[model samples]
Target: MSNDFYTSSILPYAAIIVKICRAYTNTQEDFEDYYQEVCLQIWRSRKNFNGQSEWSTWIYRLTLNVCLTLLKKKDRQHVASDYLPDEASEGSHVFADESLNQLYDAIKQLSEVDRGIILLYLEEKSYKEIADIIGSNTNNIGVRIKRIKERLKKLLNGKVN
Candidate 1:
């Protein structure tokens, strides 16, 4: 890859990869490793990108696939909950707001797939975009979102004092 590509295409999307990694990983070290893997995958696939989708869309698809593949491998279990970083702690300043806490807490209770869906939803991803990433039909994503919302309410409400 050229230095120009590094300076332009890749660096600009660095934060996008990090956001995807955080939604998928549970701790600091794992997030770093996952982020590196995503960078590698993006570089490896750049030559193959035919512009069939937007560059960002292609990268998003690639990122989700990498995370999901890692998640499905028994040997690659993401067991770094104990290594969570201080910045992402339950009491972290970034998430000091009550609704943010409730959302993340509810998210943590969801299965990995559900968590991914909810994160995409919260990111304001179109149902079509999320369905494409997850291999689900676009028409069904809205129903799934509604169900996930109901489940989130139940999950969090059950924990309240």
Candidate 2:
């Protein structure tokens, strides 16, 4: 990808890429790797974008797909680490708030598809938009989100296994 394209198109949405990648990775090394892979895929797949959705929506879908793919490959190689590093030490302000970090910790316990759904929901994406990104109907997306929220609540309350 051209430097101009990277600066103009992808840099503005770096936070979206970072947030999705952070959710799927365990350590700082994996997070950086995932972040770089997502950006590269976005640049490589730029031509596949057809303008059917907003640019951010396309980015979200692409970022989620790349992270999920990389995560599955990692899972196949070995189990993911249960430990989370201090976000401060990683030099990322994304999870600066303790409560937010706790929330993400709970989120990590969810299934991969659920992880994507909840992340999109938390971003305040409309159910239709989420459904589109996730390839599900709006009604199904609504139901799954309700269940996911309940599960997350249990996790946060230390009630889940």
Candidate 3:
């Protein structure tokens, strides 16, 4: 991706990209890798975007797809909930509360699809927007978000099922 395009097209929405990347990656290095790949993919696939949805929505789908694909390729299992970084990673500044860290740790335990859904929901995306991004029906998105919240609560309480 050219510097101009990235600065112009991506910089504006970089926060959304970083949030999704942070949710999916454990280390600062991995997060940087995912972030770069997402930017690259968006620039490469720019032509395919025909304004079917908002630009941010397209970016969200692309970011999630890239992160999930990388996770599968790495074969890295979710880090144990008891796990905590010895020191803050590069992007740890966004989350200062210990409870937030615990919450994110639990989120990482969910399946990729669930993780994406929850991330979008937390970002305050409407059900229809989430459905469009995840390629699911709005009704399905609503049901899944409810179930995901329950599962997250269980996970946080050390009752993974």
Candidate 4:
């Protein structure tokens, strides 16, 4: 992608991409890979956008889809790491706050779909918008968010393993 296009289009929403990628990756290396892959896919698929949704909404959908796909592929590869490296932990400034790090750790324990749902919910996307991005009904999104919130609470409270 051209620098002009990236700067003009994708740069404004870099934080959104970072948040989605961060939620899906455990290490700084994976996070950087996911971020680059998402941006590349967004540029490659730009022509496919139909303008039916707002640009930011489209970005959200695309970012989530890319992250989910990459995550599944990584799962299939079965790469395992028992501990986070010091470099990775130090580099991830996004989780600088201890509470935020705990929240993300709990989020990582959720199912993939729940991870997406909760991330979108945390971003404050409306029920209808989340349903659209997740390709689910609004009622289902509402219910899932409620359950996910409760689950997160349990996790944070040390009530669930």
Q: Give the residue spans of candidate 2 off by over 4 A.
A: 79-94
Best by lDDT: 4
lDDT tens readout by residue for model 4, 115-158 = 88999898899999999988999999999999999999999999
Specify the highest-TM-score model's number. Answer: 4
Write the number of the candidate with greater lDDT, choosing between 1 and 4: 4
When summed lDDT is taken over every stretch of 10 residues in candidate 3, the lowest stretch is 81-90
Each prediction's RMSD over C-alphas, in Å, is: 4.3, 3.3, 4.1, 2.9
Candidate order (TM-score): 4, 2, 3, 1
**Colliding pairs, model 2:** none
**Compared to the true structure, candidate 4 yields what TM-score?**
0.89
Tens-place lDDT per residue, model 1, 43-84, is: 888989998767877777787778766656623554666344
lDDT (C-alpha, whole model) for all candidates: 0.71, 0.85, 0.85, 0.87
How many pairs of residues collide in model 3?
Answer: 0
Q: Which stretches of candidate 4 lie over 4 Å from their true place?
A: 79-94
Per-structure clash totals for the candidates: 0, 0, 0, 0
Off by over 4 Å in 1: 1-3, 74-102, 159-161
In model 1, what is the error at residue 151, expressed in angstroms?
A: 1.9
